[model samples]
Target: MTSAYAAVYKEWRDDPELFWRKAAKAIDWIKAPQKIFDAGAGVYGLWFPDAVCNACANAVDRHVEAGRGDQAAIIYDSPVTGTKRTLTYAQLQEEVGTLAAVLRKHGVEKGDRVIIYMAMIPEAVIGMLACARIGAIHSVVFGGFAAQELAKRIDDCAPKLVLAASCGVEPNRVVHYKPLLDEAIELAARKPAAVLMLRRPQEPATPTQGRDFDWTAEVEAARAQGLFADCVPVAATDPLYILYTSGTTGAPKGVVRDTGGYLVALEWTMSNVYDVKPGEVFWAASDVGWVVGHSYIVYGPLIHGATTIIYEGKPVGTPDPGAFWRVIEEHGVASLFTAPTALRAIKKEDPAGTWLQRYDVSRLRALFLAGERADPDTIQWAEKILNVPVVDHWWQTETGWAIAANPLGLGMAPVKYGSPTFPMPGYDLSVVDDLGHDAGRNEMGTILLRLPLPPGNLVALWNQEARMRAGYLDDFPGFYKTGDGGYVDDDGYVFVMGRIDDVINVAGHRLSTGGMEEVIASHPDVAECAVIGMNDAIKGEQPCGFIVLKAGTSGTHERIEKELVQLVRDKVGPVAAFKTAIVVDRLPKTRSGKILRGAMKKIADHDPWTTPATIDDPAVLDDIADALKAKGI
Candidate 1:
């Protein structure tokens, strides 16, 4: 059968300019682009080179103008605060307009940078849209980020204003954001002119008299005066947002996303990749601070006129292991996207699949996983337990949208155990060897994309054009190096092994830690695991596995460790050098649930390493260090 995705892929590849032009029509642009793509403009490919439009108009106002005013735009579900709020397109427009006016009154103008340091509340989305409405570039720092990290972003971007909340409600405790914001303000070299504070009613906080202004007061006053900021027409290449991503060197790189092309790419993904129809409920369980939330939860769904759920709850905490299932049941979510780490946690909490039977997940047409590599064991477990096709897709902070996915919206592809399906329509992905030559099928190599890159890709690093070129472009000449090691099978299904740096060289043999972790996780006793390469005397590097056992699993540490070692040997090979496996109570992870593999690698190597600011729990690092010292590795 000629699948819907195949047809679109063929059309897009056949004539990319015509394909993108037709796709761009889905958006309501003030000035339609004369040219679809301009690849001759340096390394950063330009999309809609001559177009002028407002991202806020396409995301919110267009739906209201087209008589979809009553349609739900955002559904705020915060289990921690026991709050539920739904904003229709009309209501959202009013809120965004009022806030936009407040921003203008505060001296924020076009091309100004605004730093948003708020919790996962409706105001966060409002702030982003408001910035877009007034043509200000927004950079949202995760609410849990430390003051030092926030201060770094402030200094780098030199934002004109800082939008923050008093506190964020979590299941265990309340996180005070105001104190951190105040500290960051003091620490920042280039301070913002004003800090707008949103008060959470549950935990009321008073704002500073001179520096901080109450968001509610400002918005209400603007509303009373009947003042609203008009959408500013910006060039297609105008930056929409600057999101900072961590590099291997520990310094963060600010990835710049443009306005016009981002909208077109996300809108297309909402329907084609997510299989979501207009007005259908879609939920991407991620924070607005990350790229996943920026693309799927906020922009993609909204641009497609779909109801997006902004969930402020953990997969386990906010209630129980069934929180995600309950959300799908309550909201009739047609598409549910989340990280593989989250699913692994859920599975660990309820290994018997008890949560699956409690909720009626029939409304869920598909379950998507991203943010990291999805192991075959987890995918199989999720599929069997949920009885839904568990689609694992691949993307990056630089891409802004899915690069490879199953495309269930077009036609359901047969689920491959570890592969993230085929490359999306607009991307030309290939695996390259060390010399930048194309590698054979099924042979692992660095992933590269033939330039010019597709729309929605990062245009340049904020204030670091040379760094952007050196980091991504210079490595492979004409190709954009993805810095990921993976291979495509004969059937053209790409299976991402892991980051290229994560590949371990053991005695002249290369082994992927991801592949080894997958084998270890397949063990019944193991809940989750991370593998890192440690320096050795004879062998170049030795693989060390850190295992987190499933709840109530019975086994001695020594016995289970030996079993895991043998399991890796049997599955991967004898040359894998999977010598040691240590059972730990918990694995270090970020607030977003990504394992701190780099930190673990440092610990394994017995090198001095500082705990990352984004780590969810610092105690885990101590545990890892103690374990490594005891083993005398």
Candidate 2:
């Protein structure tokens, strides 16, 4: 009954029903629902039964009415184009209303789906909030996702309308995404009616016949028609949005999140975890397509009425590494949230910079990193270089908002550098073994959330992929299995070790190795291939492919290798492609022809688990080892 770990969520664990309802008081709800629970004893959440509320209205409307109208909601920048803009609470309300009116003209009704294909521009947030305001679910595909990846999502959702930009700005030159967007539209069977374009980069884009029209013009037309109506009232459990997780499975699983329960959790997270000040400027360096952006960038900041910075360009592009610091100084940014992978990239590009010295980031008091655990070196680098404590928060797409956070300003939990600290106000977190028994101090096992799913947790899966309930929901009965292998130390700090299933994390991106292997093995010359993660100086782990060609494979080493790599690149985009590929005469295998990928990694990292189970062809394993040893990688 006495859990030292869950000092916060202990109230909820004792009487979960009461805790969830009590947590609801944290937010300014439109119509507080009649009941938190619909069914009986063992059954859990149906948060606000038939309650009518809007996510953006919660974010924009309520905060302004609370007399925070002049507070900046988002500080936006397009560094590549040398543009800067800021939206206050009042400004954001107008933008959302205009865009919501635009969607209404395009027939985006309450249950309609709108796919937003834009970079990390403020308009992306504008578009998303617009959809939320009108009760239409918006799915934003990450801009970097290849045409094929985009196409698959488009086909899956079959969204009513699409909101995209004419071009995108990265760190370097302008990336003309129109070509790829056009190509993807060509591929989709039931294509979107029209492509609304936000034309600013001016790249001489000839519209694609009747299917294409200007984005700004359409919104202007909508403004002429009438502003968006008051938020579409719905039950708290009504699906607000559906975000697809990056490829951890063959098919992307759509995580449907509702309005009320989600906002309750996010509002609590912004207040308790970050201890956000109303006027403080907050920047989360993530594209809206990812989960981090969804929570922190859009919902969390607005919930707290903080100035959320949305940078359209990559950090490096804005005059090298000085860009982030400049924004902090310019916008008077109080807090910044980002991933370690991004920090590593910036550090690699600008180690000892004139930028750091020239820029004033005194306004930046705290830093936060999520998506993956922060590397100790990066944490120290942030503290030493920026002279601010880097607060690390850990949670998954399923758990929604900050599950375990090192709340520096709020709770004064001492820093563990790379560790994910204590659970939030309403999460019953436990580390358990295979048999469902709890793990003791410092014992590593699966992280389980004994459920009545947490407030921010995924409610249900989308149509066909609803079977994921078996992969997730039914596993531990009431408890939602996190499926990650992690451990809780004596200090109550959490360190995630990787996924139980062959899900690999390459530079903080979660994906399936078997998913890639399956695509690679389908190639004609490739009889079989096993992908293994090799520790890289830059990326946390670089995936490498070891292959044994089929019979009568005769192409030269250089030629065949290039083709194989291309095959994978085409199959699953550059992200899933192997960093290195080794062609061996025969792969190390058991008598049953199982490739020993673990042994392959043992060449780079001499760990015991990296050792293969048992090899029938041990000599073949030696041959592959000799090849990698020669390369010294």
Candidate 3:
């Protein structure tokens, strides 16, 4: 009954260097490093420092060289635009080469930073690979990001060029990105030298002659001239990309990922965690702007020579609740990965599972959930309805890939309800107390990882090495503090409750809001829920729950609220102080689908808080505030 992960874990723990070295061989490195890992320099450990390789070569050219040129490398499905296209490996290589030549012709050089602000299209992937081909670093901002936010990233990275599309087609609207890009450049302190605009045929925008140029024309001209950018060799530790993470407070921090280690680690995850084989269609429903898209959607699958699906549509919209199922069926997707929030939306929109049953998902091998903690209710519901093994894994933007998963590639472990199973081969994780000491089994504490972090993990904050060290390493000296509160059970299964700061102090006891949320979400009528600590003069802090009900379900607000309160009280006890509940039409969330608990807390506390640029709907905050006031809280 033992899982294959047990044997793999034993092998990994016995000699970590040998394990990683074997993993590194999956890619075709131009010059392999003699050393496996070097931690002598600083808190930011270096892996394969002496190796020289091109990320583009490993992801694109190598497969074509191996005679897999005719295989589909990417399938672009944009339900918003009613478009579907596939690019073979050879075609993608040529397109990437042409774009790289265009970048070089625009004076982009090795080691220069390029800003990519494009939609979730094949062109975005081309831009990323083109930068990698020329050894130029790329910083991709989410297409939906506000001009102010994009300007901030531009100022920080000081990219030589900005690559953007004219517009993005969403379910309900067409977002004009050209105007936003222009505004961001105007607001930026250090503007890029030039802007390459990808013009969509559906929504045309005029490009300025000198400062801006059409990306399509440049690529076509380069291809006609038989010009292509040659892949450049770069030291293993050379900067690959800088991705800025939008924090709940203050300025965003740019996470720097290196070239060599990222490729090796991601290649390993393809076979080890995702269990993906070459030519298999792997769909990660995420924007290319986020880390999941960078690691899973773009690089990981390509490095493994698997076909990746770049979807430009919402989980529920872009037609209906059947959109995802339709995509899976059409693409013959083998492995599917997405966020828990998306699953919640899908479950809400199609409560009876009628839409999901209409499509054939037999080709799907696994469904992975991340970005946020997957509640037990949603996981079980998805598994039951889809008839697939639904797994919940945990990681962060800092860590490019999954740190803990069920390891479906090895073998399926018995599902542990809300737990993400075990830590991966290279990650050393533990639940620690306030004193930085390991907590006992089943004890909730801060999650930490014993350094040095595995390859593919961030090396340092972009131009903020001191901040990186102080934020992660200095907290516990030897361990990288995750800033999340959770526990490891006796079986070694990890339960990520939520962010440590989200823990509420009720009277003298501390209660995790995520735990309360899980209970509330377990209710049949509840589709999704967010729990926050509201300031209370008597109890110090009380748990206030906001819930979104399932479609076609009808009940009095008072009755539903009472049921949720009773569920929390019964599950977490009276110490949780979960009395108040509000039914909301929608929860304020970031574009990435993370619940804006901080904003919810501010509204519940009756404090003033500004709408973040990352929020999908800023007015939802006002609605929540109004609902709170209407409840006389």
Candidate 4:
């Protein structure tokens, strides 16, 4: 089949303004934009600078007005709590309006900031929409985040109010969120005016006198009085939300997304990238705190009038490895978007996909992997078992959407093992060497996006415009440095090897640890793996492989380690100098499933390091340390 990708890309490249202007027609605008783009506006430029719109109205009110009120808007499936609930558009509209009214009653106005620190529940989504409905900026901190980190965000945004839940239910324990929230408030320099607490039956919170408000009581009162906050018109360049990047150590950079361009871009991607029609079930198994949840889980699907799922459970442990399969079967999910780490976890627990066979996943047409590099081994495994196209796309927290993707909705290109095929419509991707010149075909270098980043991408850092320019623009003149090291192959496929820091110098040769990891993961006995460069006295740096064996693998650790060393030498060549390989039970990762390679590298080098705020489990780091010590490194 001939893919329309080439012609469509050309259409965008030839006249970018016209393309985006056409896309903007799908959204309902309070004041239509006459100026498509204003290069003199922002840190870079601005899109739809003269337009006025409301995100909540486009996502909720308009859908209801269009007579799709009976369609499912959000499907909340929490296996941890044995709960299943679905809210239709009309129902969601009512709840969102009530919450908006509550915010208005508390005096939150346009551009005021509100912080949402709740778990993966329906209210969390409601809080975000409520903020948008009244033109208030919402910043969602990851649930159960460290108090110090939360305090830092609190100080940065200086929110007028905070919305939180009492507790977060995990498979084994109920995490008390109230205490954490209180502690953070105590630590913060800037205090919120009020706190709205949602009391869960598992763990109810004590209200602070004259400060805390009950969520149920507030909403009920608002409904009884017929008080609902209507959508407020915001400038096209107005801030919608502030999301702190998870990987930061000190003060986190709050990525700010604008209203007009974000809606247009997300609406375009719904049919052009995800290929799901209105009312179709789309599930992104991610927490609302992360970029995936912000884009795919909340705004993207609803703005496109599709049913989105809020899954609160592990990929493997909610019941078994078949948990995701059951959700797919039950919800009739057309597309599943998640990190590759989730798939690796399921594959490690059930290598043969025995549990998957028990459920009918025939309704799932495509599986989209992002947030982490989708290794070929995991992708091939998912394709073999699910019998669907496993598309690996690439983007970042700053971009808010895919920079390079296969464009599944445009047409499926021939699958390449390691590349995220072709840059998306807005990104003009190029690979440059140390001196900022173009790199040779398939040669490793810093990947960059040409100037004037596409719509839906970050407009600026919250209260830090100078920092934004220094971090993204100053490094490369006229190009946005992606901070990722990769290459563009002769076929125009973009291969993101890993972060720029992941490239290590072996004597004089620069090697990509991601490439070595890809080779290590190809072993039949290997379920998951991470390759980090360890400092070496003679070679300057040497590659060390830490691997987790597949479930029920018959090979002994010693034999498999030897085989892995040989495999890297054979595939990546001896120039890799890949001699050490350790077999561990698991790897350290963040809650969002990104492998904590930097933290692992810090531990491996015996450098002073603190536990990452985003780590999934701190105990895993100790295990990694023990494994490294036993190897006599």
Which candidate wins on TM-score? 4
Per-residue alpha-carbon lDDT of model 3 for 190-211, expressed as tens digits?
Answer: 9899999999976688887689
Of candidate 3, the 10-residue stretch with the lowest lDDT total is 244-253
Query: lDDT of all predictions, in order shown?
Result: 0.90, 0.72, 0.91, 0.94
The TM-scores, one per candidate, come to: 0.98, 0.78, 0.99, 0.99
Q: Candidate 1, residues 478-560: lDDT per residue as tens digits? A: 78899899999999899899999899899998889999988998999888999999999899899999998887888699999
Range of the 10 consecutive residues with the lowest summed lDDT in candidate 4: 1-10
Sorting all predicted structures by TM-score, with the top scorer first, yields 4, 3, 1, 2
The regions of model 1 sitting more than 4 angstroms off are 247-251
Best by lDDT: 4
| Better candidate number, 1 or 2, judged by lDDT | 1
Please write out the lDDT profile of model 4 over residues 510-619, one tens digit for every residue. 99999999999999999999999988999999999999988899968999999999999999999999999999999999999999999999989999999999998899
Off by over 4 Å in 3: none
Candidate 2 RMSD to the real structure: 11.7
